[model samples]
Target chain A: MPQIAQIAETYASQIFWLLVTFGFVFFVIGLDMVPKIEATVGARDDKIAGDLATAKAAFARADEIEADYRKRDADARSSAQHLIAESKAKAAKETEAKIKATDAVVATKIAAAEAEIKAASTSAMAEIEAVAADAAREMVAKISGASVTPEAAQQAVKAALVHG
Target chain B: MHQFAIEPLFGTDHLAIGGYNIAFTNSALWMVATVVVLWIFMLGGMKRELVPGRWQAAVETMTGFISNLLTANVGPEGKRYVPYVFSLFMFILLANLLGLLPLGLVGLHPFTFTSHFTATGVLAIMSFAIVLIVGFYKHKLHFFSLFVPHGTPVPMIPFIFLIELVSFMVRPFSLGLRLFVAMTAGHVLLKVLAGFVINSTNAGAGFGLTVGLSSFALMIGISALEMLVAVIQAYVFALLTSLYINDAVNLH
Candidate 1:
């Protein structure tokens, strides 16, 4: 039979690391989690603030555009009277120009919103992919004892997505 | 080659490493295997499919187990910490059970399963403690002050600090010992019983075969018992870890 005392002596160090790893894990959870949550909250706060700022600026821009439209519209109205007495073409051209300018600004804002949403979605998906791949690497090592390359993980992810 | 001895070499007076007794050791190899296995167990089935396949489902169960644990102990604020807690449970559980596999990823050859305290195991516990310490540091002075109990007299400061220090120091020991003892005891029991079966079979009575059959039956029963012990020990380790963190974080 092997000596128990000898086993203890030899294993003392192994025993030490196990305890160490255990503590690190719990430590990460207990400590890092709170700040992560705070960061999330902070991000949300910054987003809300940005949104409010953007809306305020948009309102200011819209006000200027409306004032310009009204001025141009009144000018067109006065020109229309002249057209009735003279030529209608100039009044119609002024109205057309005002409509085009307002439509351009609205379209620009729509495109920007779309771009922002697409960017956010793309980043979120990529983050998900990375995390899933990491978890897969670990699992494959445990279950199959095979080292999987990143390309393989991507393939596995693709396969999962197909089935999913 | 001679038949392999199921028993491990625990200690040797002849071999010395750093003035401490040394034996041909194999536990570290098993730890590497455990780490690899743990990585697999955690990462496998992580496709996050709405309707998970078998592998994913099994992994999800473990994930859910850890997630639920963090949620329960640390509250909603700590739910995000599920990854760490689950990873911890998996590491401890896998390491504890690696020895039981007759030919787990790598067979328990003489190079492994031999007795020697390995730093890998110590790494597990120390890493755990360091995480807590770091967490405490992250939480800053508020966390350090946790060592002092509220409403205590000013005279009790040093005494309290000493008690808390000793308690924190023992955290790894308690965590490692619980897992180590459970595993070692279970395997030793299995070995001793197998020895009994061998000895009884060789005793050469008319009823030797009958005795062997009974012993074999007992061995089967013991295997089942060990399986339960394995899971229980894992739970105990994880639960204690959560409690320790709760104390550190909330500082109650």
Candidate 2:
């Protein structure tokens, strides 16, 4: 019985720890372990979020640089187009001026030629009148077969005019 | 090595306290020792910091297990009961596992030695009772008529009443017995196996080694099995407690 009692004592200690464990578990429940767990999870979540924020910022920065380059290229291309159009317009204006200047010179030459022809026409008409006068006088004298005095000539001119 | 034997509750003479026989049992000693050890463990862990040592981490794991259990099973309403559940789980878990240790009855005659003085007695019974009482107390008047379902036929009500009553009365039994039987059986099997090993070792020269080795293997296996059972029984106990509470609160 003494030996048996001693053996029970050995097991007794084991049972004690068991009871203690039970008490502890129960106490933990009473103390509200849920919120503490939440707090732990919350802290972990915050850390992940912080990391994500950093990653996002870096990504945004990379995107911004890419967008900046694209914008600059677009601007350059449009400006180059604008410059090309301006040059084309200026070239057209210069070509038009040169053509108008050439047209004016040609018009001036035509006007001078027209004036010279008018003067020549006037001289030719004067010569034709002088020749016609001489021919007519000589024909009249031949037809009359006499030389007449001035008064007689006048009368003869009158007669010839009446006869013609 | 000292041999173990079971001592009866009363010797040839009875010890009387208020007309009830009292044995200054190994049970009382074990209970006190468990308290002291738990207290030490708690104090060791309670200096909660971001970086915890091994013991603290282990304690925290236990706490976390119970917390998650409550959150998963009983809903957040049972969130406030974390400590109680945790305490319940730890107590039952360790108590079940305690049988694995070398605590046995000691005696003079080798034949007289037997295993006894289990922790599963008054302490476990009382703890479960306290849980039931407190659970009901929390629910108050709402706890009564818990068996009576909201709607039933007038004629069939009595039959339902009896069924419900029986089920209701069976709650504490199932809850308490689950732990008691599981712990007791696990320990008893280990003891029986140990007896066989001892007997075999006493037989022959080379046979001792084989028996010892087999015993070791068996112990290891039972240890692992008991460990699982410990947690499971605790879970069942806590789960039932919460279920009863839920029943009281809903009481349709």
Candidate 3:
């Protein structure tokens, strides 16, 4: 084979060129290019991890804010309910006291009115008895032709009103 | 045989260095071509995009494959040798595949330098040299213990060590010969099949239709197989180099 036959002649050149070319590849590619590629990959991984951590922190912050908002909402609702209950109780107590005072005033007024009516009715009854007695005495004198005294007339009217 | 012949380029056959014929040959041309192609391939990776384009991804994939291979075989210390092994792997791989390029249709013959034992022998020696340098530098005389197993019977130790020592010494020769023989054989088979097709076609229409057509089909299949072999041989070379480095690094 020529591979065997030409080896003595070609080995030197082949080795020389192989070293030169292979050395270029080793320095330019392996030493220079590889590290750059690895760095880029490593940087991307770091950036991804950083972004993920940021997102996680933001998510946790949002959860905390939501919890705080819910707690404040519950506090406001309970306080408003307490205020409403306090106002209702105060208004009800004020209403009960006012009603009791009005009731006492009305009762006093009604008692005064009943006393005035009794006094007026007693005077009217006396006037009505005097008239009836005067009429009775005139009728007695006219039939028998006898004069009647005023006092006797009052006494007779009183006895008749009492008997009736 | 002509494919494998070393013809001087630019009429440099008259060139000499010291007493040796240092004529720039087709093999040297292919070696330079391999470097140029490799540099162009590596240019994609220099773009340094976090989101790599397809070209960059291809570059990264090859580097990553070698990087991972070294890491697995030789552990963390293998990281220091990535450049040498990467250069070795890509050089041999490109040489092997470039040789199989179907450029013959355009009246160009591609030489597979790896088919020459001298070229592969030098590569194998480089790897073997690294192993020796690392093993001795790290372990001193303990590196000799690599030839002896932990559970060896004292009586059998001498024989076992002899076998291991011989096998260890055979690594470079076997490594170089494997690649050279594999590449040369495939090319030879393809050339022989091509001869069959051509000869049968010249014989007559009946033979051409049968024998030539069958050989042509067979050549196509074998060409594809050669492509696979080209890749496999490159990987095997790099993998064995890493494993051998492992033995030196780990002393087992």
Candidate 4:
């Protein structure tokens, strides 16, 4: 009851100061402090979100670069394969050409040898015919006790050579 | 008992201005102390470091806590009242806790501001004013329909409306009285218990010592409980304010 009685005497002063203190607090906290705090929180959140976005972008860029590198690597590998295949095909073609050139040279050499052998055989035949004629004439003369004609012997050799 | 007394600090009588007394009193001094401490706590705690320091974290936590409270109670519209609500909560909380400090040094008499009806009553009325202002501004005449229950029978409407009106009118008084009574009662009980300890110790030394020890222990326990009550009462006061504002804004 005394406390209650004291309230009347004390309330005006209490409220006067309460209002002053509260007004100061309301403006200080409500207007000044709270907004700053809210802003800090907002800014922190934004920073985090921005950092995450940057990280995500970096990841995406890395993935793209990796893909590009893989593609280039595949291209290089395929080009190398193509070069190897092309060189192999060229080598095979050159080998075939060399073998053909060798075969042509062998064929030419065989023809030349054949021509030389023909000439030699022809000369030997001619000489043999001459000797045969001389011997034939000598034999005929000895048998018949008469000289043989050269012109007739020579013609007979030619006829015999042509038939052989 | 002398702790609760209000003697003018400046003059023989309270200074008057425009037919209103504005003399500074014990209650006013403590109220100013609460405000100053609140300012220091809030401003000092805000460094806004990416990873906050202890004080910054405290400030941020309090801000977030009040934001959540408003969101839960008053929805997004409650965002407008964050400063007011935050101030109210801090004012009561600091007032309660600061009272527990041994501020009576040399010749200074420290008092608990929230324990006074004038302080709590003004806060309660201000809270009610927000509800009324917001309710009427948003809902106009439909604000009065807050008393109308959704499924009430027509015959029972008058009775129910009367009950609702009475309850509605008593919100401010209840808010004020609850904080005032709880704070006053707790302090008074502590004082009385302290008196008992002194009285028992002044008796014959042997019996007195035993009684003094036990009573002092009980006092310590109760004081701890009172600290809890102090925090709880601050929370309840703010929570009820938000709830009242919710009822006004949402009319539910």
Candidate with top DockQ is 3
Worst 10 residues of 2 chain A by lDDT: A1-10
The sequence of per-residue lDDT tens digits that candidate 3 reaches over residues B1-252 is 899998888546567677667677788889888888988888888788878899988988888888899999889989888887888899899999999998889999899999998889989998999999999999999999999999999999999999999999999999999999999999999999999999999999999999999999999999999999999999999999999999999998
Query: What are the candidates' interface root-mean-square deviations?
Result: 7.7, 6.7, 1.4, 1.5
> Which lDDT values do the candidates have, in the order given?
0.62, 0.59, 0.89, 0.87
Chain A of candidate 4 scores what in TM-score?
0.57
Which runs of model 1 end up more than 4 angstroms from their true locations? Answer: A1-164, B1-25, B104-124, B139-145, B148-164, B206-211
Residue range A19-127, candidate 3, lDDT tens digits: 7777787788778877777677668779899999999999999999999999999999999999999999999999999999999999889889888888888888888
Error of 4 at B137 (Å): 0.7
DockQ order of candidates, best first? 3, 4, 2, 1
Question: Model 1 residue A53 lDDT?
Answer: 100
| DockQ of every predicted complex | 0.08, 0.15, 0.49, 0.42
lDDT of 1 by residue, B24-134 (tens): 435544555665666565444445444457875676566667666867886775565555656566665666566556663464352223122243245346446744785
Q: Please report the TM-score between candidate 4 and the true structure.
A: 0.78
Task: Flag regions of model 4 displaced more than 4 Å.
Answer: A85-164, B12-14, B45-52, B104-108, B151-156
Scored against the native two-chain complex, candidate 2 gets a DockQ of 0.15
- The whole-model C-alpha lDDT of candidate 1 against the native structure comes to 0.62
- Tens-place lDDT digits, model 4, residues A1-164: 43577877777788888989999999988778897897898899899999999999999999999999999999999999999999999999999999999999999999999999999998998888888888878888899968879777778878987888
Cα lDDT tens digits for candidate 2, B124-162: 454456545755776676665665677778898888889
